[model samples]
Target: MHRFNAYRIFEKEGQVSARLVELGIDDLDPGEVLIRNSHSSVNYKDALAATGTGRVVRRFPVIGGVDVAGVVVTSGDTRFWEGEAVLVTGYGMGVEHDGGYAEYSRVPADWVVPLPLEMSSADAMAIGTAGFTAALAIMRMEQNGLKPANGPVVVVGASGGVGSVAVDLLAGLGYEVTAISGKDDQHEYMRHLGASQVLSRHTLEMGKKPLEKTIWAGAVDPVGGEMLAWLTRTMKQDGTIASCGLAAGIELHTTVMPFILRGISLLGIDSVQCPMALRRSVWERLASDMRPRHLKEMTRTIHFEQLPETFDALLKGAVKGRVVVEIQA
Candidate 1:
């Protein structure tokens, strides 16, 4: 029972608080596989759970992180073995169980995926849950007949982790990308990620009609609320919009004209409980043809000690792109 460091969150008297502490393997929730965590990433969901901003944590005094990449220390399941590189995202990692904000993570073997070939632990964490969600959105869109030739794609909240990765992945796949963000400072960064157009959130007019003049052929909408309603109104016939996050607000107010007249598809991406088969397929695609071209540029690695403060910036929408935590280092 080796002692390792973990960041645990607690709820006391209707307040949420978290602090780093040391624990043995027996202290963690039971699982078949043990991972020596090398890297993890800070995502929006992780921020919410850690800070109690969204009340996502199901259990108190649990380690807080939704993404983990590491080497297998031991496994009861035959699918994995010692020294194998692996990663886990979603499937109740941070909320329902002790998570990756630790030097070691013991998780159900069914929840793990072998790290893709040629993908290092650092690279896997850089993608993490954010990139996985973005990729899942695109996967569904393509299944609905979305292609680069369909027309330009628009990504809302384009300066954040999922948005940045979506922009890069879409552009890499030859789709013209239009990025929309409120941060003027991020426009150039979006352009660098291969966006053909960057629209400021402040200047755009969200028309009030059930159906406005069609613009986008597809949309990666992480921001809900008014922005999502606008997309539903403005999508072209047969267009598909992948609704991933509710960062702007969860309430979507719109008419049925877009669905009836235009035949639009609103795909809800649930990365948390994604089927293990599709999850593995998506991870393979992420490491291969769909790999993000700007991962290094869009990501910065932070030491494990810097984890707690990163959540505040994330929740405030001040952080840009991805923040990978070097847990082992």
Candidate 2:
């Protein structure tokens, strides 16, 4: 047994507020492998958990990071020996159980994925849940006929975590990418990720018409609500829109014209509860063809103690790119 620092949140019943505390390894949940967590990344879900906003956590006194990449310090399962590198995401992390925010985490062996040959622990966390979701979106799109040759693909929320990685991966695969973003400061950054063009979010705002001129052949949307509805109407006939987030809102007020008249396909991208078979396949693809080129350039690393301030900014939409936390010294 070992001792380590962890950022914890304790919430009592009938209370909306959470008490922040730093605790030890003895506090972790039961599992087979004890990982000396090296890195973790913040996601929208993490932000929700951090701020007690979304229903991201049903359990009280939970650790609130959804993605972790680290080295195993002790293992009860043969598949992962001590010192082996691994990563974990989804499967109730930061929600139903303790998660990656701690310097040390004990997780069930089944939830652990060995680090890919192409990725280091830090690199894996740099991609984290956001990139994993992005990759899953692309894979689902391809399965539904959104091929690389399917004209041009547009990515909404283009400067955010999922958007940034999606732009990089799609462009690397030779797809023509048009980025839609509200932040003009990210224009050069988006271009660096291989976006052929960047459209202002205001340009796609709700208008009087039910349908406007059709443009992109496919789309990866992380901003739902009006942005998603607008994309559905504007996408080319038989186009596919992979809807992943609800950063804008959950309501999708769209006409049936886009689906019935244009034969457009709206694909829902669900990273959590994705079947194991598909999850394994997506991870393989991420290790191989789907891996982004400039991962190091896109990563933003922070120490564990800095999480509070960083998470505050992230909740306010002030953060750019992925924010990976270095947990263990």
Candidate 3:
């Protein structure tokens, strides 16, 4: 049996640490299919898990990555065949279960999603969990009556992975996207992602009122905390906000005035446990009309060995866009 390299995380004495180790296939957690992983991408959650900055990993000595894309090397499940391209995200990965920061990943067939529309594994990982969550948010918001003609849509935390994808996706669909970012350096990058307007998080007034002047027709908010509360007060009548992350803080301080008076809706986006049918459909759309136009330009790849040194930038919110880890070739 051949051994492969994996970035494994361990928790001991209430402290977490990770390092690269060699492990044979038998050493990994058992699953129906074994994938020869080609690429994996860094999400904010991945950074948090590896750095022990967040309580994300539930199991000790688990591989550390939330998203992986590659070709099936072998499958005990009849649903998957060798050489088929697939990707897996969320659903206990990098948490209670071993994940994709390895040369190979073994996962339950149920969690596998076939690479949609002839997409390469690199492209799949480029989009990764972040892009999927963004697309899912847009899908949910549209079902709640959001559209290009519904007026402007604002994306909070617009320089991060999900936020960047949201800006590009919303703009590709014709919505006038206003990107909110704290980084002064990323305003031009935001504009390049199709943002009609870029708002400086440090300079913009969030305003103090139960209900502020109605501005956004819709909002893709991942920042939470005060930003989410601000979004609730400023949405147009019957507007929707898709809450995806808590990068700023989890606590939400908002009144029901917007919900009751303006008929605004707050839709929580749960990409981790999203239903399979919906997950597949959203990914199909992502490969089609909803794919980010600047995906290649917005992404950069690093060799697998570079993984350990890359998380600090993501944790510090310094990275501009997506970072794909090339595990093979």
Q: Pick the candidate with the highest lDDT.
A: 1
Candidate 2 wrong stretches, greater than 4 Å:
13-22
Among residues 3 or more apart in sequence or in different chains, the pairs in candidate 3 whose N, CA or C atoms overlap within 3 Å are: none
Q: Which segments of candidate 3 are over 4 A away from where they belong?
A: none
RMSD (CA, Å), candidate 1 to true, equals 0.7
C-alpha TM-score for every candidate:
0.99, 0.95, 0.98
lDDT of 2: 0.85
Cα error, candidate 2, residue 85 (Å): 1.0
Q: Per-residue lDDT of 257-282 in model 2, one digit per residue for the tens?
A: 98998899998988877887787778
93-129, model 1: which lDDT tens digit per residue?
Answer: 8898999999999999999999998799999999999
After superposing all C-alphas onto the true structure, candidate 3 shows an RMSD in angstroms of 0.9
Candidate 3 overall lDDT versus native: 0.92
lDDT of 1: 0.94
lDDT of residue 276 for candidate 3: 90
